[model samples]
Target: MRNYWVRIALGALVIFTVGMVARALINRGIGGVRGVVEGSGPLSIPLAFIPFRLGGDKLGTLERVTFERTAPQSVSSVRLEVKLSDSLLARGLEGCRLAANLDSKDGHRRLSESTFWCAPAGSDTALVEYGQAVFRPGEVSVPLYLPQDLIDELQDLNFDGDSTPISEAEIDSLEASTELSVDSAPVLRARMGDSLRAEGMRRADSAKGVPSRMADSTRSR
Candidate 1:
């Protein structure tokens, strides 16, 4: 009887241990999905994953959201591309402004922020103005400029105050919140999920068939 009781206790302990491990793994996965950079530098969060809100109401659905650093060595600029939902467009985007806020890992620090004026020219499709660049709602190439002080802060954080070029700086994690102006107040907000990884950047570059400068330099060597 004593041996049987011991076996039962051991079985229970094993089950409990396995359950705890599985829970931890599941939580880790959830956290990653919530906000973790991909292996590449670009952070593309699907619209379906983002929650949009306008005051007490849920804003309409968006099609896509993408944020990416333009160049391998450039850390002062990033591109933000978002596809406005039909409901949002129907509400009118003329004279609206799109803004983004970038926060540090702990969400306690504001790394950088930028805003672009949106002036739609049509209903189904429109050219929006961001700085001197004009682009359609879904297609994006213009880079959002970051402040110099913030750029310095980002570089120091990634490089540990070292002068090493940030060509491959591991940003690790960042939180991006996007907003759209309605009636002069931001009515739509979406927080992007996760960190941006260097590995993913390489994959993106390869997929675009655009060789990185690192590769070009290596070939020249």
Candidate 2:
């Protein structure tokens, strides 16, 4: 019986190892940004083992983000691309979306309080496109995309005839009203979700030597 148990344990180990290696191979083809350096930073998001919708508590936000001016030969454009892992996506997602909070030197304040659907294919990994360029990398909050329904609620907030945008505090208050809480990570908030967006905008605003055609798209805001 002892020998049988040992064999079972060994078999489980082998299966686990093979699964890990297979996941790595599957992701090897996906290329991340080359010039910009990565760091283990405060950027994080709630995660889960099973479908987060099923009460699984887990999170993995930004592993790292930094600014790099020297572009590699392989890098033709300024679009920042980040790859998600296969194993993580396998757990299932309530929804895939992105948010940002950035301040541009040109007096551009970007805040995507609403969630934008980012993952269309539902593949093992998702390619999150900022659709913007970062010219100067700054401290930006990076968080997983908030649930789509939650974002809809934020978007539906009444402006009440005020032409100007709502304050960040109001945004925070709105999020607080939801009373949403996650066991692994703090409930998503506008300020935290907008970190990446703001950083990308700052980079785009400060970026130099970009093509003229691409320039308009990056600076449209």
List the candidates' TM-scores in order.
Answer: 0.30, 0.20
Any runs in candidate 1 off by more than 4 Å, and if so which? 1-48, 53-58, 61-73, 87-91, 101-221
Candidate 2 residue-wise lDDT, 59-156, digit = tens: 23222222122221111111222333332232122223333322222221222222123334443132333223111123222223323332332233
Please write out the lDDT profile of model 1 over residues 1-221, one tens digit for every residue: 23322322222122211122222223334445322222235433333323222222223433333334343222323333333443223223323343323334332333222223232234212222222211234233343333344455333332122333212112111111222121233344442111112333444456566556667878999
Q: After best superposition, candidate 1 residue 203: deviation in angstroms?
A: 41
RMSD of each: 20.1, 22.7
Full-model lDDT, candidate 2:
0.28
lDDT of 1 at 21: 20
TM-score of 1: 0.30
Cα displacement (Å) at residue 194, model 1: 32
